[model samples]
Target: MLYRLMKYVLLGPLLRLFWPAKVTGLENIPAEGGAILASNHLAVADSFFMPLRVPRRVTFPAKQEYFTEKGVKGTLKKWFFTGVGQFPIDRSGGSAAQAALDTAIRLVREGHLLGIYPEGTRSPDGRLYKGKTGVARIALEARAPVIPVAMVGTDKVNPIGSRMWRPRRLEIHFGKPLDFSRYEGLSGDRFVERSITDEIMYALMELSGQEYVDIYAAKAKELLAAEAAGARPAVPAQTSGARDAARLPESKAG
Candidate 1:
C-alpha cells in the first residue's frame, strides 16, 4: 500500500537521511492496540518526523483545507497526506467539530494509533498552551491510553513562514502511557474532561520542557496576529478560577 511504500521505500529514507531523530522512550508505544499519542505542536514537521520514527501507522485528523485547496500544488498535498494515512476533518466548530471527534473515536475503537495535538494547533510562542478536551473525550470513549509525545527543535527545520525545510537534528521524547480508566464512562462530563486534558497538558509540558500557558494556542495566534496588524489585541480572559473550565466549549480545532 502507499503508506508502506512511503514509510519504507520513499519518504522514510529521505527524512532519516536529513533530519535524523534522537528518539527516546519509543518502547512506550504499545506493540498492538489503540492509543492516543498526544503531542505539542511546534512545527508542521512534527507531523512528519513523529510518524516516521514510530513503528506503527499513525493517523491524524488534519484540517480539511489541506484536502480542499484547488490547483496542482493542492492536488499533490492531498495525495501525500492521503498516502500517509491521514484523515481530513473540518476544524470549523459546531456539528463539524463533533464529526471530527467522532472520526477520531471510531479510529481508536478500531485499534488504530491516533496522533493528536492536544493544544489544538502549533504553539505561537513555543509555550505549551491549554489543551482542548476532545482528546480526553476520545480516549475515554475508546478506553485507550494516552501517550505524551514531545518533539524538540522541529521549529528550526520548518520555521513558521518558510516553505523550504532545512536539515536539522531532531529529538523525540515519548513519555509513559497515561491511563484514565478511573474516570471511565465520564467522557462527556465537561469538568472531568477538563481535568483529564489538564493532566495530559501537564505531562507534555514536563516532557517538552516548555513553559505552560493557561490560554489556548488559537487565542494566542489571534492576539499575535492582531499585534502584527497594529491593532489592539483583545484582552485574554482570566483562566484562574473554576469558571474558566466551565466556559470552555467542548471542542476546538486540533
Candidate 2:
C-alpha cells in the first residue's frame, strides 16, 4: 500500500537517480523470513537509501521528534515516515533501551525485515563504533539471524549538519548471516550478548572498511560535547543492585 506506492511511484526513481547504490552480496539477504539487518549508521540517508534499494520493505524505528512537530510540515514528515514503513519511538529516558528492544523483538517475530543501527546512532566521524547489546538481545529473543549490512559513502550525501543532500555514489554490501543459536536462551547474559554484538561488528567493519572504535557512539559524542564545553566528561554512575558484565571474567561467560 503506502510502502509500495512510495517505492514504485514516488521515491524509488528519485533515490536511484540521486544516490544510486552499487550493491554487493545482496544475495546474502534472505528471500523470506525474519532477520535483523544490523548496519553501521554513517548518514541520515542510510535510512532512505537502504529501504529504497532493498527488494523487501524494511522498517526502522525513527526518533519521535520526526512525528511530533506541530504544523503542516510536521504532518507531511509523519506521513512520509509512516508511508515508508517507519514508526516513531522515544530515544531517551532510562527505559528507552528496553522499549526499543521490545519493539525490535516484536517486529522480527512478526516476520518483518527489521533494520537496526547496531551502533545505536550514526558514527560521529565515519568510524564504526561499538554496537550495543540490544541488537544481540533482539536477535536471540526473536530467534532470528543477524545479517551485517554496510552502507558506504552515505555521509557525503547527508553529512552531520548538511541540510541539502548532495548527490554522490554509494555502495551497499551485505555480509553472511551470523547465527547466534549456540548462545540461545542466554539473552540475559550481557557477556554473551557482547560477544554476539562484537562478532556482527567485526563483519561490518570488514565490509565498510571504516576504522573501528571500541566505544559506543553515544558515549563518544558525549565526550566530544563535554570537551567542547571545556568540561571533563562525567563518569557514569555505578549500578546499585546490578552486576556489571563488563567486570565479569570471560571464563564465566558460558
Candidate 3:
C-alpha cells in the first residue's frame, strides 16, 4: 500500500515534473514472473527512476544508512524507502552479502521483480565499471532470467557532488531477458559466477555505450582510491636557512 501510494502520489509526480524519463523496451519485461533487472548505476536517482518506469513493483536492496537517522527526518526517510519497496542491505562484504543473497532469492521465489545494480555502486565517472559476481550468484541460485537495463543521461541531472537536481531527459532501455538455466546445476561455483557476471556486463556495455573495466567492484574501489590519493598534490620540501646550513655542513663533513 505504501509502495503504491508513494509511487502514484508523491514520487511519481515529482519524477514526472523533474526528470521526465522515457522508457523503451519495457515490453521486454515479463508480464508476470520472477526476473532480475540488472542495471548500471550512474546516479543516485537511478534507483527512483528505474522503479518508476517499470510497471511491476521492483524492489532493490538499499544501504541501511538511509534508514538509520533520528527524529522526523529519519522517519520520513525510512517511510519513503519502505514505500518504494526497498529493503536494507549492509554495503559491507562478508555476512552482508549472504544476507542480500538470501533476500534476493526469497524475492525471486515469490515471483517478484528483483532490481539490482550489478556494478554494486554508482559509477563514479559515469563509465560502466565491472559488475560484482553477487548479481550472477543471485540469478543462478534463484534460477531467474537477467534483464539488462541501460540508463542514460541520469548522471547529468544529479551527479556525484550535486546538491540540487536539474530537469533533464532520462532514457531507460531494457534489453531482452538472458536465460542462465544451462548453468543452473553449477550453482556456488566461482567459475559460473564469473562467466555469468561477464555476460551481464557485456550486455550492459552494448546498451549503455560505457567503457567496460574487467575488474570487480572491490578491486575497482581500491584502484579508484589509489588513483585519488595519487592525484593529491605532493608536499613541498622544507627549504629553511637552518636546514640548508645543516645540509651544507653535513655535505662538507662527508
TM-score of each: 0.89, 0.88, 0.86
Predicted structure with the largest TM-score when compared to the true one: 1
TM-score of 1: 0.89
**Candidate 2: where is the Cα deviation over 4 Å?**
226-254
1-254 in candidate 2: lDDT tens per residue?
Answer: 98898988999888998787899877888898899999999998898888787789899999999999989999999999998889888878869857877998999999999999989898887878878888889999999998889999999889999999999999999889988887778989877888777778877877887877777889988887887798976333322211233233334545
Q: Which candidate leads in lDDT?
A: 1
Candidate 1, position 36, lDDT: 97
lDDT of 3 by residue, 18-101 (tens): 888778899999999899999999888888999898999999999897888779999999998999989988868888879878
Q: In terms of lDDT, which candidate is stronger, 1 or 2?
A: 1
Q: What is the lDDT of residue 238 in candidate 1?
A: 39
Off by over 4 Å in 1: 229-254
All models: lDDT?
0.87, 0.83, 0.81
Better of 2 and 3 by lDDT: 2
lDDT of 1 at 46: 91
Give candidate 3 regions above 4 Å deviation.
221-225, 228-254
